[model samples]
Target: MQLPDGLDVGLYPIEGFTNPEEQPEGNGFFITSRYARNGITFGDKYNRAKADSIQAQFSSLYYGNYELDVSSEEKTPVDFSAYKERVADSINFVIEVARKYEERDLKLLNKPMETKAEFNRKHEYILKDYPNAFVNYDYRGYTVYINSGKRLYHFWGRNAKDSGEKSQTTEMQVRKSEPEVLSLLNRFRPRKLYEVPTEQGFCLPYGFIAGDSGHEPRNIGITYRLQNHPDVTIFFQDLGMKPKAGKEDDLNEKDYVIWLWNWQYQWSAVSKELIKPKWRSIEMDGRKGVGTFVKSVYKDGGLNYGYVAYVQGDRQARNLKPDLLLYVMQDSRQARGNPPMDKDELEKLAEHIVSSIKRR
Candidate 1:
């Protein structure tokens, strides 16, 4: 079947089963049980088994089978049936985990998922007593109160950090005790900091981009507020060096320093149609040349966000390519803030990031 563009075709063989009743849809092979006993339906068992199998695959991919065995408290024989059951159980657990993960991910996708326009109305009561106090979506999964300016005061959600899965629902908790809002604002800090070196002779920290709640911890196309100046941020990197076409000054705008291995293969595959026109090139550290792109986003009636893309190369042999990088980077920027960048901004940022790479 035709898959979405940029999906790793190599991964198709691993997609596993969508549901148990249907045959394994892709190139991968999976087992199904038809026994209908003890109120055990074929479809139910099938689904459970499939979920277990997918979890097993994910576990194996992330934590090696050996690692899983070491960390697992249940030690059992490695005979065929035993091994199969073990794997199946792991997959089942993963499926259960995935269901909850999807719920939390959905919450982030739609900030304040349940509470609607009534939120503004109900919030007015709190606003009356605490005038600067307002509720805004926090990290995609919880509600947070900001008081007296943009200070974070109270937040509500499960603390899922220790457990790779969502925690049980909890009540609203105050971030700070002060009825004053600004007092609470200082508690929240940016989780990731990126230092982007551009040819323009400046290395600036690109602040507060975005991240994906679905993936748990990966930050995508992280946009940053331009701190006094606009700079580029490189999301992907190739590890080999290509021959320099000419003196750095003589290098054309289209020429880029790429990992030789990627230049020969991967760079050709990235889509350029989504790139914004504002992108341009800049010199890097007065020594090497790099590609750069920028996008500006306006929200609440003003320009509040910008995305920068940069590329750099060091003499080495490794796998790196703009297209492949873009595939991994496509949605990472959603993690940083609430009221996330709209689809158009996201697409433009993705395109600009991919297009900034050039072949020498």
Candidate 2:
């Protein structure tokens, strides 16, 4: 099977079932990277076509799995046979999850998996008591903790009220509040640029222009005058799913507009939580980068949303703020149809555009 452009498949060795002879004929257990929160453990008659390797390969960083010990679960223990039935029932959902993970949008379903730093920061006090404890997986909105030896698994989250023998878990009912609209775009005096940056800031420095002329920098409109900043020039394109009742120049679904904002200054940390659950930190040329999808719905029947992909670096003159930020905002889904570009495609396009930026 052909994988997505940036995705790869790996064959993880399921413990005990590693040997074809030791396996239960066609029956075996498999789990996804999202097994913790999504509660997706699949079991089915193994197909040779799906089995790419017999020795187990660590081919993809986004997914890996090992045999699950379903019988040992003290809380609502489920036998292997029953578990297989459940997997069969949710096969479609499981497949969808796998597809989305491959597209790098798994966080839209559950919160992004906690990085090591994040896990430690939230569980410092608990870890002090059990220094040997380590995180295994975040299942069902709870952090599963395992001992240093990896012999035990415990669930922990916002409330670590439930304690288990050899398993210390936190149990509580918590709901995530929707994030507020960032409102940063509204603050900008917009413009558009089709050509790659030819000078300093976040574009190709002293390089030939690229992309079609239609995409080159141009006036958003005479009405939305470009606001001149003493230190840097800000270019942006308005991203609205639908034009207001009387506003003719407002961007609409058919316009196929991809708003790119290029500005340079000293960089400050951007809070990922403010964007959405789909955001992730990235790195480019040793500089911090961030990317995410944003959607906001208005009670008055208006919608504002898009994908954001940007990178920041200090590669300019010392006196001037060296940080450069390149952002792209695409219109949200419209009543007419899906946006011109989906989150994944929009991010890739933005990354390519930003790649033109260079240091003086």
Model 1 lDDT tens row, 40-115 = 1111231334422221221111110001010111123213333334335534544444444445657667533333
In angstroms, how far off is 194's CA in candidate 1?
7.2
lDDT per residue, candidate 2, 1-360, as tens digits? 011132111211122121122222211223442232211111122333332221011111110011111111123322334333333444444544444454454444554654555433333221111233222221123332222121222323333332322223211111220010011112111112233344322211111223222222211110011112111111222211122232223332112112221121111112112244554564433456565554444444444434444443222321122223334432232213423444455455555644544333
What's the CA error at residue 33 for candidate 2, in Å?
Answer: 65
| Model 2's TM-score against the true structure | 0.22
Q: How far out, in Å, is residue 308 in model 2?
A: 3.5
lDDT of 2: 0.27
Q: What TM-score would each prediction reach against the true structure?
A: 0.20, 0.22
For model 1, what is the error of residue 118's alpha carbon versus the real structure, in angstroms, after optimal superposition? 64
- Measured with C-alpha atoms, the lDDT of residue 351 in candidate 2 is 54
Badly placed stretches (over 4 Å) of model 1 are 1-281, 290-312, 315-360
Off by over 4 Å in 2: 1-279, 284-286, 300-302, 309-321, 331-340
